[model samples]
Target: MHFDTRLFIFIIINIINVRPNFGQYSDDQSYLSSIEFNRGGSLTNLIFSSPHGGFLGANLTLKKLGKSLNNETLTTILWQLPVAGCYNDSLKQCVYTLKDCLQSNNKILSYHPDARCVIDRSSTLSMYLLTKAIAQSFVSHYHPYTILNKLTRQYVDPAEDLPRGTFLLESAIRAYIDYHRLIAIAKEAIRSPSRGLFIEFVFHRNSQTIQLGYGFDPLYPSTMGKPSESTMHELISRSGPSVIIGNNSLGYFLRLNGFEYVIPMEQSQQQRQIRYRLSTYSTRMHADQRFNAILFSYPIERLRKHSIDQEAKRIAKAIEQFIQTNNIKILSSFASSLLSVNRIMRLCVLFLSQSFTMLYISH
Candidate 1:
C-alpha cells in the first residue's frame, strides 16, 4: 500500500494552524452536558455568568461534608440546592432523582420536608427565563457573552475552589474545568485593548436590595481610593470612580427603573457594608485580568415568573447605560463579521483534517 506522505503532512499542518473557534456558541455535551455557552456577537465587551444556577443532577451521591444536619437545615445553609422531591415519613429517606420521586408519588416541596434529591435551586425556571430575556434585549444592537452551568451544584460548584467545588470527584472535576474553560473562551472572543466587564449573577433570598460587588472589602469606604487595590482597578483607572457610583452608574439606572434599594447609592454611607462581595474563587481569578468583574446579587424576588422580563430589561438597560457612560468601546460589525469568518474557516480545516486522516487509515 502506498501512503501519500505529502498529503498527510499537509493535513497535519492545517489542523495545527487552525485556531479554536472562540466566537462560536458551545453546548459541550461531552462533559456530561454540564455547561452551556452563548457566544456574543462581539458587538459588546460584556460577559455574563451564572455559577450557582443549575438544575440537572448527576449519578454521584451527595456527600455530607462536616457536621451532620437535617434536610431542612442543609437546604437552607446551601442556598443553591433546590427541593427535588419530599418524603412524608421521617423514617424513609428521599430519593436521588426527581423522576424517581415523581414515580413513587412523592410530594415536591421547596423546604421543611425530607428531600431525596436536591439540586441547585438558584437556576430556577425564572432565572433561566431571565437570562433569555437579557440575551434578547441585547440581540439587536449589543450582544453580551453568556455562560451557564447546567449541572446541579450538589455535584460540582464551579464558583468555589477546586477542592470544595469538586470534592475530588472525577466527573465533578471535569465539569468544573469545562465551566471555567467556557468562560475563558468567551473572554477570548471579546479580546480587546480596552477592558471588559464580567457580571456574575447570584440569587439571595436574604436581601431585597440589589448588591453590586467589585472585590472591595464589605466595609470599605465608598469614596475613590487606590485603584490598584480592587479587582476593577483597570476599569477604575480608565473611567474613574464615578462610573461605578455616580449619577450615571449602573446603580443609578437601576433606581431609575424602579428598583428602590441598591447598594453604593450616589450618596452612600462612609462605610459601605456590602453583604455579598464578588470575591468568589472564579470571579477573583477572572477579574484579575483584562476584565472588570461585578458580582450581581439580587433578591430571589426579582426572579418571580411574572416579573422576570421586566427585571431583566431593567438590568440590561442599566448595563447599557453604564457602558455608554464609561466610554467602553464595543466591537464593530466588521470585527464581529471577521470573527464569524474565522469560525467557518476553522470548521472547514477541521473537517478536511479528519477526512484525510480517515482515508489514510483505510489504506
Candidate 2:
C-alpha cells in the first residue's frame, strides 16, 4: 500500500512538471479565444491586450502574413547615419515559401532594429513606479521621461472616458492579446474543470518584430496609455476640480470598468535574443555594439533564410535548456523571487534605451 501511494505521488509530480511544455501557440499562425476569470463574484473584467507585438497589418485571408521588401529605404539610408530595420528580399518576394514556413515552423522573427529613441518611452521595469504613475498620473507624458508636453500627454491619456486618465493603448493591448490571449488564462473548476486548464498561445514566429529589446522602449504605447486607470479622474480634471485624496494613501485598483491593465508579473520571452548574444560575442543582451547585430541581423538577412541558421539553433537550444533545467520551473513556483510583469519589464528596459538613442539621433 505504501509503495502504491508513493508511485501515485510520483506520477502527480511528473504531470505537473510536464504541463508548461505542451499546448503553446505557433508563431506562424494567429487565432482568438476567450479568457474567463474568477473575481470571487466581484465582477472581474476581461481586457484582452497585446503590448510587445503588432499584428494590425496581418491578414486572416493569408495563412502567413508577409511584409513587403524595404531595401529602398535601407539603401537610401545615408552611410553616415547608419542603417536600421531588417530588409528581407526573398521573403518579400516569395509568399508561398513564407506561408509554408509559417505553417511548419510556427514562429515569426520580427526583425526591425530601430532603437527606442526613434519610438516612444514608457517602461515597465519598476513595478512601484509604473503602479505609482497609474495611481497618480504624474509621470512624464512620453514615458520614461520622454515627450514633456500637453499634446503628447493628452495623446496618450484620453481623459474624457476613463476617470483615472490611464489606459492600456488598444493597439498594444490587441497585440498583447494576439500573442498572449491563449497563454494568460487559467482554468476554472466551477465552469469546466474536465477540460483542465487551457494554455495561452505564444504567437510563435521568427519574423521581424519591434525592437523594444532592452531598457530601451519607454514610450511604447502600453506604457504611455497606463495612466488612465479610473474614469473619475478624467471627469474631475475636466470639471475644473483637482483630484483630492480621501484616505491617507492614493492608490486604487477599482478605477476602471474597461481598461487593459494586466496583473503585473515577469517572464522570459527574450530567451532567443539572450542566447544569440551568448553565441555571437560571449555577450549577453545588455547595451553594447554586438547587441545591435543580435537584434537586427539586418546585416545578415540572407544568412538567416537557410535551414541551418546558427542563431535559430542557438535560440532553440536556449529554450530547450530553459525547459530541461529545473531552475526556470523553480522560479515559476516561487513568489519571493518574482519580478512584476517580467516580460513587459524587460521590454520597458528596451524602450528606455530606445529613448537614449532617440536623443542621440536628435542631436
Candidate 3:
C-alpha cells in the first residue's frame, strides 16, 4: 500500500487541536513562556520524552514552593523511592537517577528525606530534541515538574498539609487524566486505516539499556497496533545487547510518558490490596492487548557513561532500524490515484503544513 494522506491529515488535525498553546506568549521573558506539552511532528506513533530533563523550570517551581538550598524551609525535594533507585544515600547523585516521588515537609515520611537528588535526567531533553530534528518525527515530553507539581500541590501551596493517602490519591487522579489524553490520541490515530505503533521514551539512571514493552495476554483489547514477538526480539537483537537494558522501561515510561500502566483490580494479589485498589481507577487504564506500546529507556548518566551526542545518534538509528525491520505499515493508498502534478502539489502542501507545525511545536 502507498501513503495514506487522509490518515496523515487526521493525525495532523488531532495534534493541532491538542497542541499546547505556546503562541502570543512566546515573547514573554520567562522559560515558562517556552514550556509546552505534546510537542512534536505528526503522522507517526514514535514518541520520546525526557521526563526528568526538566530541571530549569522545575527549580523555578521549587523556589515558588519555598525550596531553598541555603536555609531549611518546607523545601520541595526531588527524591526517588528506595525501590526506584540502585544508589544508597551515601552515593553521589548519578545520571541514571530519577526522583519520582514528590513530597512536602508537612507530610510525614511522604518521601525519603535523605534520598533527595536534584539532578535533571541529565541530557534527555537534548537527546530527544536531536532525534526529532534529525528524524523529522513526532516526540512528546512529560514535564516531570509540571506533573509532580500537580501531584504534590507544593507549588500551589507548599504549606498545604495532606493526609498520608491524600497525596497518593491526588497523584493517581492527575496521572490518569493526563494518561487518558494520550490514549485518546492513540485511539484516534489507530482508527485510521494505517494504524501506527505508539512508542514511549524514558530514562533509567541505574542502567544503560533500552527496554522494550509490547503485547499482552489474550484477555484485553489492544489500543495500539499489535507487533509480534519476533519483531520485538529482532529489534532488540539489532539494537545489540549493550544498547538494550533496564528493569521496567514499560512501567516507568508509561507513568512518565502519560500512559499510566494499569492492571485489573480483581487480578491484583498484593498484600496491600486496598491501597492498590484505591490507586487502581478507570483512569489508570493499561495498554490494551491490541495496541503495541514499545518503550525505550536510556541510561541517565549517559553523558558521563558515554558521549551524549553519540548516544542520541545510536538510539535514533536503532529506532529507525526497528521500524523498518518490523515492516510496520502505517499508511495506504486510496482508490484511483490523481495525476502526477496533483500528487506533487499534495506532497508540497503536506510538507509545508507539517514543517509549520513542527516549527512551533518543537520549541
Candidate 4:
C-alpha cells in the first residue's frame, strides 16, 4: 500500500499552486533582441536551440521563442532563419544559425546544458507545434522577484563567477510545460484527436561539454566538476549497484528499490556522475537540511519495515533535532517538502514537539 501521507500533503498544497497550462499566456509574451551569424557563411543544416543552457543567449532566446510559437508564420520563419554571431551591433544573418545547423544533422538532434539545472520540462517531446507553444505560454505567465523573471531560481552554484543567483530550471520548465500544453490543445482542436500522437514528456538533462572549451578555472563552475561527465565515452548506462540520486523522486524510488545500490546521481541521458536536482518538491518542507546529501546517509531502509508512519515520525524527530541544534530555520518550509507521506506527518508531529518552532506554527 502506498502510505504516501507526505506525498498527499504536497499533492494537496504544492501541485495545485503550479500552473501547468503555460500556453494560456501566449498573446502577452515578448522578446528583447535576436542573434546574428556571419553574412558570408551558408547556414548550418542542423539546428540546436538551447531553451536553457546558453548563459548569454538564454534571456534572448526566451523572447524569440515566445514570439515565434505564438505566430504560425513567425515560427516557420524562425525554423528556417539563419544567423552569424550572437548579440552585437555587427552585421550578420539570423541568430539561430547554430540551432539550425544541429537540426540539419542526419541523426536526431539533441540538447543538454549543465549550468541550467532545475526540472527540465522540455526533457519530454510533445505532439507538435503545441509543445513549443505551451512552452512559450508558461514562460509568459510566471516571473521572479524584481519582476524581471518568469520562474523562480531553484539551484545556485556557489562557485559561479556571476553575481546572479536564482533557480536555473524554472523558466525552462515553464516553457516546456507550455509546449506540451500547446500540443494538447492542438490535438484537441482536431475533429478526432489521435491517441498515438500523445508523446511522453519527461523532465531530463543533457550535456555537450566537449563542444564547449574544457579549460577550467578554479573561480569558474562547469558541469565537469562531477567525476562522471569527464569523458564522452562514459555517457553509456548499465544497470548495476549504481543508482541515480538527486531530488525527492529518487529518494522515494531508492527507498522503494533497494539499499545496496550505489547512491550516484546522474541525468538519464548524460548518465555520467553529474549531481543534478529537478522538481525536488520536498525541499519546501520545514527542515532546512531535510533534502540534501543527508538523504543518502539516512537510515530509511530499516525505518521502512516498521509502520511507515511510526518510522517517519522518528526520522522527522531526528531531522528536526539536527535543524534545531544547527540554529537553522526551525520552520524551513520548503526543504523537506518531498519527504515520504508518513514523513511529512511525522515532521508536523516533531514540529509540535519542539517548544520554540511550535510557537510559530500555531500562530
- Among all candidates shown, the one with the greatest lDDT: 1
lDDT of 2 by residue, 1-363 (tens): 012455446544554443212222333332221111111111111111111111111111232233434312111111121112222355542221222222111232222323321322232212222211221221121011110111122122221112111122333223334323232231111121111101011111233321111112212335323322222222222221111111110111111211111111122345223321111110111112211111111111223353223333332232223223211121232321232234345554665576567667777
Instruction: Return the TM-score for each candidate structure.
Output: 0.66, 0.19, 0.38, 0.19
Q: lDDT tens string, model 3, 1-363? A: 234578678755654444221211122332221222343233343433222232211221111334323344443332323222223445554222113233345443234323343333223354345333334321323111111112222211111112211222343333333433444543443333433344444344444334343322211224212323322333333342221222222333223332223222112344123221111111113233333344444444545745555555554544555455454443333311222234456666876777677666766
lDDT of 4 by residue, 174-196 (tens): 34433333333432222111111
Q: What would the per-residue lDDT of candidate 1 be over residues 84-162, giving only the tens digit for each residue?
A: 5445355465544322222211222222324454544544545555665776688644677777765656567787666
Candidate 4 residue 213 C-alpha distance from true site, Å: 28
Supply the global lDDT for candidate 1: 0.64
lDDT of 4 at 155: 23
Worst 10 residues of 1 by lDDT: 102-111
lDDT of 2 at 294: 14
Greater TM-score among 1 and 2 belongs to 1
Alpha-carbon lDDT, every model = 0.64, 0.22, 0.34, 0.25
- Lowest lDDT sum, 10 consecutive residues, model 2, at 192-201
Please name the candidate that would achieve the greatest TM-score relative to the true structure: 1
Model 4 bad stretches (over 4 Å): 1-65, 68-306, 329-363
